[model samples]
Target: MGIPRTPVRGVAALAALAALSLTVTACASEKATGGGGEASAPSAVGGDGVKTGPGVTADKITIGLMTDLTGPYASFGKSLTQAQQLYFEQANAAGGVCGRQLEALVRDHGYDAQKAVAAYTEIAPKVVALAHVVGSPMVNALKQRIETDQMLTLPQAWATGLLGSRAIQVTGTTYDIDMINGVDFLTREKGLKSGDRIGHLYFEGDYGESALNGSKYASEKLGLTLVEQKIKATDQDMSAQVAAFKAEGVKAVLVSVGPRQTASLVGVSLAKGMDVPFVGSNSAYSPQLLPTPAGPALLKDFYYMTAGTPISSELPALKKLAADYTAKYPDTAIDSGVPAGYSAAAIVVDALKKACEGKDLTRAAVVAAHRGQSAWGEEFGTIMDFTTFDRPASLLSYVAKPDKAALGGAVVFEEATTSDLAREYRVPVG
Candidate 1:
């Protein structure tokens, strides 16, 4: 069954939304720390507190990371590991942070919360803070403990429920905020008029649940009708859900599963003639996931949001980072998680550089520096900001599509559109 299509206009509406987002983010930034701070260029260290070069010396500073190196999100987790190792390795080669070399102690929790807790405690005393943590539950399990102990956590994705906390730095827009922005774009820019039926195909977990809830909240807020489908991360079958969406006549679908599951859902949806465009958070938007058995066929109209520009040759920062990474680790591939891992590491390094201001590199000093500093990095279109109370101030995401021609015959990478709808939702900066 086919549904009535609503004609949408984009050029002007998207531009207006972008301007509005910038203003809102600026107001939030002023509220975050009360004043505009100076913006720094490419150097990792900021101000006088930061030790130049790879300053993570054995006695000075040690960074610990808890990741799912061999679990459900292992693919992304592995890329994160590579990013961290490669970033620190380069930092060390430069000189080190604060004249001290950066040291990263990473452990695998298999994406298990209990195991993550155990690993957190085990790694607690060894490092200054936990940086670039991967999973929602794992981070949730350790949030209180990290806060109580006054440690820094750079969570890769955004969750609004995580706001107003001290121990974390969110990399993207909050789930609620982002959903609202996405809905606004769909309705206003994409002409997804009011009363349009929206669909959700989410995994059955906290991560999925968060996205689902956010989607519902946004839909209801914007007067959009909705259909819901729940799947497990382990589930390989999505025909039933695809059928349901088709029958319900959903105009657009919001998916919250990982890469494999997302591909499966898209595959079934495409094969069954379900042409509804699907939108997803960062988790579902992987270059590696798009080339699986039934990937391209399913993800034809697939669009997902990300917090950064991603690693494209067009972005000089990303280009430099890619060059650095390739020089350091010649065998690895640069996928979705690689840039994120670098950004996450960059956030932590920014904080540490601030924290190390005018003092010997110590955990206490690092924590203090993070608390006292106003913001990190130039919010140059990326969601990297922080304050004393608002740990994760902003998030940035982009819309990307599979590039069959560019990736040779494989079509393993996602090429970004010049104006991604996701950019309209950037949490503004002052």
Candidate 2:
């Protein structure tokens, strides 16, 4: 769980979810190797004399991270991992977690499913759980492996399919609910009539599919005309999809996509003389969007619906965290993914504290503690009742428009919303 001044450079597992290059400094730990070190690590064998889980010794716990640092989503992955590192570093600075230091094993998948699987295979054997991972496609591809191992994971994928995994923990909203509420915001606040045409564009993976489910549900309930198009993760051009929507004469667009495609969609749509509004799901807006050649086009059309507090919220805790994180990283702006990564690590830290109450610190104990929570909220906007795993712990989201001046190029938050209908949907475990 602990390594002293260890530098984990790229080791051929997963890519940073979004950043191009990653730099991490391991926290110092006394039980890093357990050879009569100055700090005492919890013994692998409890007083009961039984062996414990993988990546757990007398004094440390090891966790894994699958990022997309070198891929299309590299910025997201990199930002997430950096924030995670910072969170753990802070925890260590505060005297480690329950007398045990947390160690992170990170790999870059470059957004490739096969690479994700390989990273999981290599890292899983050395860690107690996956603190976070990159893409929905990769998670889906490795579901069986994860289930078979019963390993605890804080997934990067916000898909409904994760609802059934006893080993996974999610407190924030899901993509489907966020998108549903997004459309609801559009209809209620953005001046869209019930029957107005709303075009849709999404990826073919769990993340996009989940968002599509929400948009579809909203469109059906609100009587909006729905025109849908699916894109691949590798796709950089969206002219065809834009053409299709323009041909449909859609009044606006709903995107369950990401920044790269968001830019392409806006540029192509604008170049085609179709300047309709575009509302995106939480993960759609990337910091790079506003700096791109298509930045102005996006500024003219794109808005985002976030599953948690917008990284730009003026809420006291978020504000402090954003300020502190930026101060620490200096060069990086506070983005949506930074707070997300920090909170995800917060949940793990809390659960680990619970598991170590009796000094057991077993993987089973950690997973059980996570699922047994009566109420869980990272004190960000989202809150959860883990009473069951049929749905995300919560389904609250905020609506924000893309602005160049925002710290992360994401600005403006106009009240958060949660759909009542989303609560009625069946979230399946796969």
Highest-lDDT candidate: 2
**Runs with alpha carbons beyond 4 Å of true place in candidate 1:** 1-60, 188-190, 371-375, 388-392, 405-430
Candidate 1 vs. true structure, TM-score: 0.77
lDDT of each: 0.59, 0.70
lDDT of 1 by residue, 1-430 (tens): 0000000012343244344334434422322221111211212343445432222333345677776555555555656766787787777887867666776777777667798888877767656676777776677777788777667787655655455666676655555444555555466546687788988877675656656666776677668897989886667567788888999999988867766566667777777888767776666655544345555654467766555555653566776777777786565555666677887777777667775556434544565666564545443246344554443354333554545443211231233222233344332211
Superposed model 2: Cα runs more than 4 Å off: 1-44, 47-51
Worst 10 residues of 2 by lDDT: 1-10
- Model 2 quality (TM-score): 0.86
192-278 per-residue lDDT for model 2 (tens digits): 888789998988867777778888888888899899999886677788998899999998898777666776788888889997888
